[model samples]
Target: MLDLRSVEIGYGIMDHARNQGYATETVGALIDWAFAFASVEQIHAECLVTNLPSISVLEKVGMRKTKEVDDRIKWILKRNSVNEA
Candidate 1:
């Protein structure tokens, strides 16, 4: 079962719109919204190792590697950890 304190994030950009920062901006905005507007304590995301763009988005938004299950990497960001200096 999914944790009540956490939510999973996912996004897809069309082929024609790749690399224009939509995925990164949208994911970051959603993270901020979740932490600001709800009781969410953490957020999770998963992407394949070969998905460079998705990896970049996750990193840019301050997510950290949690684990690798099979061929996918699990990433996470906690509410207390957002915008840390």
Candidate 2:
């Protein structure tokens, strides 16, 4: 799920469909849509530290790692800091 000030988007794909780049594509597309239409200044995501694939997806979608607390890592994609593909 991605959360901004007052808007949030969430998704879940079955285990069998994991790790095929589907999450990355979905996240990227959503980010694009959000930045284009939403009033939020940044998008945020949280993932378990052990979830490498999820981490990759966040980075691929232009979210930078900002901080970590215990087993979770926090990521943020700012409107002005988006990395163009």
Candidate 3:
């Protein structure tokens, strides 16, 4: 089980998995799993602003860019938002 409130999602593709849809698929499933609990108001993830591929995956998984501090971009997936989709 994951504690959505405190959990941070991190993902990276190995050389063999690069250019494939595995990262997106895995993040999508994790988002679904994170939002499974009623107490999970939102899920958070962060990536370096320079990581365009990672940013793309987060966006594709329904996470919105909520904050940016220095080189990091923070994304959030709200439970209510996902439920409405």
Instruction: List the candidates' TM-scores in order.
Output: 0.93, 0.80, 0.85
Q: What's the residue-level lDDT of 54 in candidate 1?
A: 93
| Candidate 3 local lDDT, 1-85, one digit each (tens) | 3363645688879988877899999998888786676676788899999999999898887889988999999888877788554
By how many angstroms RMSD does model 1 differ from the true structure?
Answer: 1.3
After best superposition, candidate 1 residue 60: deviation in angstroms? 0.4
**Could you report the Cα RMSD, in angstroms, for every candidate shown?**
1.3, 3.1, 3.1
With a 3 Å backbone cut-off (N, CA, C), the pairs that clash in candidate 1 are none
Q: Cα lDDT of all candidates, in order? A: 0.89, 0.78, 0.82
User: Which regions of candidate 1 are displaced past 4 Å?
Assistant: none
What overall lDDT, based on C-alpha atoms, would model 3 receive against the true structure?
Answer: 0.82
- Estimate, for each residue in 1-85, the C-alpha lDDT of model 2 and write its tens digit: 4444424445666899997989988998888887886577787788899988888888787888889999988887787887553
The numbered model that scores best in TM-score is: 1
TM-score of model number 1: 0.93
